[model samples]
Target: MSGPGSAVLAQLLAQSAGQGADLLALRAIAEEAGDLAAGRALARLGLEDAQAAKDMAELRELLAAWRAAKKSLWKAVLGWIVKMALVLMLAGLAVKLRLWELLE
Candidate 1:
């Protein structure tokens, strides 16, 4: 009830109010039409029920959990790769210095 259509309806209601008792029917029709439009819009948006808020909240939480899991998975993979790289570097250095021969 805050857009151009509502504004026009408000203006029409005001004009009808000043026109006299004969326009009361027109006023009632306008109000009914506004209510019907609002109801239809709510229906279209699938938000006509009390559970809509709870459903939206659950969806948001599910999305956040998915994002968190994805982030942690990437972090684990990167950490593993880094650890492997470090181990390989250390092994390469030991081979270059012939450290295995010392143990032989």
Candidate 2:
């Protein structure tokens, strides 16, 4: 429809899969129909669909790296805690056995 009063854009989208609908053609139709709002909507919808179809592998990889970093950080903290505990236990044993006096 080439008139504002003609076919509504929302109705068209609801009725069809928008497979054959071209953004440029839709804009032209909306312009000729004096409906800039519909033209903008059509362009926005087309761009959104285009972006959604793009590959997201980089996003997935970044998420994986973040998860790995979080895991590694926790492991390092736990490792440090274990090492400190062992050192403290060894010192306690030396004090209980009076090993420092023997060193003198």
Candidate 3:
């Protein structure tokens, strides 16, 4: 026996990749694989139709969150760089105005 759990999972994945396997089929495969693997199941549990949709929803949510976080981080970095540039430009302007004397 080559581990029925893995064999079933592989078959499920293969079936899922095929053109004919729709969402319902994929959920069926998941449920069957979960049943066969029992305690050793590698994926999500639950056989409800909504369960698969929930998984997809959660994945989308995570992706959206990651994108938002990435955008925020870039914006923060850009803001810091702009702030630094403004400060430097103001300092240069002040020096040129002779408001602050530079001692060499």
Candidate 4:
């Protein structure tokens, strides 16, 4: 009943029961309730500090760097696999064509 929203709700109920309701008072109470709810939500998300935005940006940058490193590593591995396949194919062609005897 002490909370702003509850107080406003109680006032509404009182008005319904024939008491005169003040529009500004009800509006102020509702605004206070909305502000309190927003504050609580920010606190719950751990973003109530001045440094929270900076911390979030750093985390995003770290994630992007990690993803780039993983992509580069995969590309390098694929390049090596392709090179090995080419070497093997050339070796098999040389053996079939008796090209080694030509070098003697």
Per model, how many backbone clashes are there?
0, 0, 0, 0
Q: Scored by CA lDDT, what does every candidate get? A: 0.88, 0.73, 0.76, 0.87
Q: Pick by lDDT: which candidate is best?
A: 1
Consecutive 10-residue window with the lowest summed lDDT within model 2: 47-56
Write the residue-wise lDDT of candidate 4 on 1-103 in tens digits.
6889677777775675465566667667767987999889999999889998899999999999999999999999999999999999999999999999999
Q: After superposition, how far is residue 15 of candidate 3 from its true place, in Å?
A: 27
Q: What digit string (tens of lDDT, one per residue) describes model 2 on residues 1-104?
A: 54664557646644444677766676676567656675677678663344543535666788999999999999999999999999999999999999999999
Clash count in backbone of candidate 4:
0
Worst 10 residues of 4 by lDDT: 13-22
The sequence of per-residue lDDT tens digits that candidate 3 reaches over residues 10-87 is 676677768676766776767786677764443445534457777879989999999999999999999999999999
Error of 3 at 44 (Å): 13
Off by over 4 Å in 4: 1-38
State, as a TM-score between 0 and 1, how close model 3 is to the true structure: 0.48
Q: What is the C-alpha lDDT profile of model 1 across 1-104, one tens digit per residue?
A: 68997788778777877876457787678779879988899889998899988989999999999999999999999999999999999999999999999998
